[model samples]
Target: MTARQHDTVGELLARSHRLGADPRNTNYAGGNTSAKGLAADPVTGQDTELLWVKGSGGDLGTLTGEGLAALRLDRLRALKGVYPGVGREDEMVAAFDHCLHGKGGAAPSIDTAMHGLLDAPHVDHLHPDSGIALACAADGEKLTRDCFGDSVVWVPWRRPGFQLGLDIAAVKEDNPGAVGCVLGGHGITAWGDSSDECERNSLHIIGTAARFLAERGRPEPFGPVLEGFGPLPRQERRERAAALAPLIRGLASADRPQIGHFDDSGAVLDFLSREEHQRLAALGTSCPDHFLRTKVSPLVLDLPAAAPLEEAEARLRELHEEYREGYRAYYERHAGPDSPPMRGADPAVVLVPGVGMFSFGKDKQTARVAGEFYLNAINVMHGAEAVSSYSPIPESEKFRIEYWELEEAKLRRMPPPRPLATRVALVTGAASGIGRAIAHRLSAEGACVVVADRNTQSAEEVAAELGGPDKAVAAAVDVTSEEEIAAAFRAAALAFGGVDLVVNNAGISLSRPLLETSADDWDTQHRIMARGSFLASREGARVMKAQGLGGDIVYIASKNGVFAGPDNIAYGAAKADQAHQVRLLAAELGELGIRVNGVNPDGVVRGSGIFAGGWGAQRAAVYGVPEEKLGEFYAQRTLLKREVLPEHVANAVFALTGGDLSHTTGLHIPVDAGVPAAFLR
Candidate 1:
């Protein structure tokens, strides 16, 4: 086919990216796009009309040509004639698989049938938050007609499948001039002869809904904000989140423990603080796309501003129990005997009166995704209220989408989860150097990391770089202060329920000879390097012991601990003390399932605050070389003549904390690029 006759897969992918990039339009793999094209059959070598649609389990924002599954249009259309009635979901999926043009590619989206039947060259479907507000309203059909006139057809709520496709096609046939159709309690569909026209139709429909809501004279877009409720500063909000995390984690851990994420964004806080939050939030999700992430509804808690921790904890337990009972009953009432077993009865999002929103998942990323969708759901619900009473799809339709085989199949096709999928890690001095590398590596392995450092601004910067509040949290920690260290650990526990791994890497260097060093200089080095490590380790042990789950503590010691240096008396003495502290702590805490270890790294100057704070220049002076040549000098000192990097040290720390050394503790691993003088026997 000529390019003028049909849109290419590249054009389709670009359309998907534009639609998916906006969360208000579509969230977390929630939308689908398709284009009609021609391709040669592998067997017959004859040109055939093919539909290139967004594949299952692929995000439209990052869609590629390879991510689109090509299917024979004739085969997909023939299925309607083959079934002739309410088609079977299983057979439809199998038929789509049979029509796949390539040997192995992503599975076609569940909406392929609808896209194939639409006749338009380009079709864009999205669960835009504004449009869904109108789609799920009690008078959604009336609202759709009022907003878009006859340009948009209204299809009542129908469980998406072969039947839904047929319904959409039937609507199109009656409203032949319409540019799109609004699926009640579902989403909007816009189609045109070109991708640009489809996108314009989508934006027009969404804008129409927004204008309709604004003209409804609701005075304000959101609900009435309750008195005595306001936003909390970031640090204070984090502290509160930390205090509530263990309780949520413990409750969610009934079958298997999960990491908890706190969302105290202004939007979340505003929604939760509303006087009518509890009554309104129970109305269920605005669209079926949110069913998988947020379940049926959120668990709302009545936490008073003046409530103590104990009282709040007790209330949380009661609310969780109520939520579980409600979930079980909802399942029992809706699920068919032949349906797959129900998913775990856990609340994905929890709304607390004074604490904002908390989302739970097996890991940080998943939890954050849930939080994001829930926030968007709030926006839709608010919009619906502003226009009229908020109405959701019926319970039966929700049940069908939640337990649909195709949806479950997409999840099943995902790659295996990482080893530290649900684990939580806290790394001290993580603003830069080895500590920063460790934090990033741990997050890459699926652990929720707490970036703690004395440099509060730097810690915040690091957390932002690691993907913000979703994956990492910044905490102001001065390890030398017991109170600050305790608070930081509390924040970590709150951010992710409980800490599973602690890396004590905060240190300072003093290279003056013993006779030349002032008492103040000597004390400063020992206090930060030795005393700080001791305090942080003790607090981490206390938390792990209380959690009743064996944890890991990895101390970042130095090569000088094993090899004496003439001018490095204070630093050397402190490093030696830290190494001994790890061994002793391991012996004492091992019985509690806590593993303690140490990594002795030598001359890791780059990115490290110690070297940045004139330590490199001091060492360079001693070596009679320029400061820039110090790294080369250290590299040559190693047996391998290779420069050791902070990332290399991070990998070693990951090895110890991530079950590689589970059965072995009290060991000091070297990460100095095979330095003969620093090698441990």
Candidate 2:
């Protein structure tokens, strides 16, 4: 597990691990786990999949840098081969050759094969005891029969190997949209694009299985309790774990990513019987969790509490062949044209028949995450079973996780926009028209927006109407003067401490004949629209750069910049320059950590100076026509029939400034209500 160093991803990974480690799960080992990064991938530039997992041997609670092993997705899929006599070692060697040639201290897990089939950025796999119990009994078939009914396809037991892989592949192939699979007399599996979802599925399955088992009543209670075996000494464990004290405290304190456990307890010891234990041991994991490790169950020796490893290994081999044969037959029956065979990825988890359990993954971190999830399920299952039995999702529902296309789609899709509780933005000329509209939109999305405009009263009025200083602040600013722009930004920063977005909406639309246009006319338009935007961009870039944060700058240009318009030379030229300045600023600020973009709109009719006031009277005077006649003139420009509003321009501006485009440095958008199309006609 290479630490994210950054707090966001690190914390997600930590939470995932803690959840997996519940003793309610078969979280001891041999599962898979993963997380999406906080920052989107720069290559695909999508804000998803910064992290992921392959749970092998370690428990999530105990995971560290050595636990997780990373691998390229493309390489993980290529391990497609079946060797009847060859063991897990040979198969793992092949996978390692391709996956970890130079990963330097990192390796892929055996479960990597199945995990590769998933598309989610975050993945976790685990097996709890109840799941295995249901998977192993003669009643196992009946259990699956009753639990899944028509929803899940119960696969007969098969030896777990390439052929078993082939069997699961068949189910997956046939379903095409299932969430996961169930081995007859075996465990269940579920998957999703995110860790929260995967863990949720794991819990849901455990609940159902626990319910089914509880119906049978407490088995006549006669297991050789391993002669009063107790949990590992907490004092000794805590003392040894002190090496991680700093990291643990930092994370567990609600400040950084925390690492701890909710799975260590006494309930697990008394809840399950030898038969239940035996059944699960024979069946393997309920699902693909504990993936290539633990051949469903572990070696169950009635030995002394502290049995040695030597005897355990001897006992482990006795159970391997049965697992193999069952896995093979499972493949023959279920695997067909529909399923993608489990091409032997690697083997980390193995059932030893009661020496507890064991599993291996590419890295220790992955092992720990799997282990933790396993334990969590186990503990939860035990408790749920104890209380009114565990009633889990039906097999059909489980199968959805077992074979979920929706989960696959979520994995493949990029991350969505985060909740907008912490964004700070400034909307220039926000007192009226489109500027005011943009400010409203930003505020609605949870951003603290500064309505910057020369109309102080109007800005204040709108801001107050929208709910005062908590969400919006009114700043009377003159875009033409650098000093004014600076003061406005300074005040906003003083209040909000920073700005992440700048929507430059301060500009004028003066219609003067080309022959009569004066230098002053052009200067007035350029100073506020072009130069004003430039000044705002410089100050924003400086703040963002110093903080090592990134921001977006949006200029509201005009559609006339893209084509010729009658009697509007000064406004057109100023808009064209404003648009050009956006690009230049984008380039300059790219290194400084800021993005610049523009929206060109020709028709924006809200409560504007022209439309809200005496627009019909003034337009009639200018055109020497009746007040009502001008409506048709404006309405005829767009093919949509609906007149364009300032809110429409605000919508486009908002989309370009947030979500993943926080990384996109330069671009221009046209929001002219199809005016350009009409112009072309």
Candidate 3:
């Protein structure tokens, strides 16, 4: 193929995105793609050969032009002369920057050498499960031969570096007809003369390998599913997962806090219940991408599926400590004088016998992705065992990659985490009004939010708007029902390990005189507001105690709770109950490191479910003002003459719990624009 047939950067990006969009093609952020083409040199106005490849840490499926690093082909290839051999390949990564054409694009990936040194005009290095399965098999080379004949070759394991690139290039030169090679104990590397052809070669390798495993592989690669280890009924499974999540998360976050993700997918359950699960799990994953996210291995909870909860908890603590010690030893065995310090000594992924997997990271996305990558590892293991004994790269090799200077550099380049990076918040009645605003604010500050509301649809919509289930999840809760309140808190535990922040914002109001208010009206008001707050608090406190993590519970009480408002009997009493509960719980939970506070907003009529649902009009009539002027009437009554919106109340919630107010508990913040009567004296 001629240089004229080379793909443009745009086409390269399109190809990459397509490949990345499918998990079958490559794991997330696991592959690199490159296209060599000619571009007019900025200095000389002369056509110059250039290499454009995926940048460091960029996912291929979401590859944008900005995510591609561009370098002068001549300069890049010239590094071959200065190549300080395999022992000093780490220096080669820094050298890639010297070959940059203009500002380049994204930071050049460590795999840059593999693409630049390769002879092909287009190259793709991917971590597809099927291809990785073939790569990880003990008889990988032999299987490669049977799977694709000579159309694809086999390359022995070598840590990813300049030498590995040279080895692959050498293989390509020898096997002139080969379109790709199964990278032994790694993944696959495919190449073509054109972008379209490169993609085809990649898909061909993946498809062919998958088919080979499916057709030629033996049945029951994982052995029989152990009877006592099979997944429990759906409800039981979830209950177990929720019950176990807090303990796992707390243990994993010993060194540094981590958000959690739970996966009960069929694939995970099937793998966990198999007889060979322990043996294979101990072997760890083969792909560097897999271990990078999931860690070198997972900490498995070894117990019968029907183990008692107390026993499970005790075993989990023991397992976590053992895992930590093992991790430290692994680091010690591999650390060099210049090696980066061990990041942490905690398991990123944890597996339970009856429950699902729990994965932890700095944020929800990272946690979720870690679980997904582990699933990929499961697939690879199953395939490898079917054809041949599963074999992973040696621990030393993984250590080199995990603590590589280049990888450390990439880590350094990452932006600092958000304020609430590892925190999870459960906001009651979060579907709309002040609750929704609070949800948005906490999420903006980096907390994973559980949008708890009776309105499931609206709650889900709010969760989606906050960035889907990773950043936020919807949990239906009437708050009044102890069962539903428990379920909502359980959802928070299941969705994000456990709750760090709970906003008791669910409430209802009724404006009626003491003479007119019936016992039923009073009961309803107290039931939905005061009683609901109590139920949510009780449930939230239980999870927080289980996690052993200090938490915040902020009650959205009203000015009416403190101020004696005219013609307000039932609603005022409920608010007063909620307000006092804050003080009472603050004192009770202080020893547990739980801080309780309340926000007193006079009337957030603009964006309030309570006010919008006719309370605004009722209050307007009580004040003898037009419904449309109710906000103005309330504002005029305030010293500041300001109309408080839901956002104002939301801001106060953050102020109390957003770190600065760490020591300020049992405090009531008035977001009422400044109503003197409502001021807490």
Better of 1 and 3 by lDDT: 3
Clashes of each: 1, 124, 1
**TM-score top scorer:** 3
Query: Model 1, which residues run further than 4 Å from truth?
Result: 1-7, 39-46, 84-87, 103-105, 217-238, 332-338, 431-433, 450-478, 481-499, 538-550, 559-568, 583-593, 601-648, 663-667, 670-681
lDDT of 1 by residue, 202-295 (tens): 8888778788877873754455777645555667667777777766766766666678777778878888777777787887877887867888
Comparison by TM-score, 2 against 3, better one: 3
Q: What is the C-alpha lDDT of each candidate?
A: 0.82, 0.54, 0.91
Q: Is candidate 1 or candidate 2 better by TM-score?
A: 1
RMSD of each: 4.1, 22.2, 2.0
Give the alpha carbon lDDT tens digit for every residue of 473-578 in model 3.
Answer: 9999998899998888788888899999999999888888899999999999999999999998998888888888888999999999999998899999999999
> Which pairs in model 3 have colliding backbones?
20-61
RMSD of 3: 2.0
lDDT tens string, model 2, 221-266? 3233434243335543232222222211121122211112212234
